[model samples]
Target: MGQVLFYKDLWKEEFWENPWELGGLIVIGLFTVTFLFFILFAVLFGLLFPSEQTENEE
Candidate 1:
């Protein structure tokens, strides 16, 4: 029996030629996920805690 790999994985030599692209992709993906997490947290935090208003009496 034989196994098959994706086209991207099949091109091992070509893939290593510019490995930085893969690293960049990983970094970009990490940042994207982090950005999404921060956005979600920001929305949740804002909904959970609204700003308090200060009242001044003369």
Candidate 2:
């Protein structure tokens, strides 16, 4: 338990101080947002304009 707390504290103090960590975090955030936006746009587009289907075509 003590080691876990120490590591947690160390991470809190060190993680943000590293440039690579910050850059990696930023890249990850951007990718996540882009992916989410794509999914949202696709869903909205599908909802707004659904494809026409005929039962006999199947």
lDDT of each: 0.82, 0.97
lDDT of 1 at 56: 68
TM-score of each: 0.56, 0.70
Clash pairs detected, candidate 1? none
Ten consecutive residues with minimal summed lDDT in candidate 2? 49-58
Query: Model 2 over residues 1-58: C-alpha lDDT tens digits?
Result: 9999999999998999999999999999999999999999999999999998899876
Cα displacement (angstroms), candidate 1, residue 48, comes to 0.8
* Candidate 2 accuracy as lDDT: 0.97
Candidate 2 runs further than 4 Å off: 1-7, 53-58
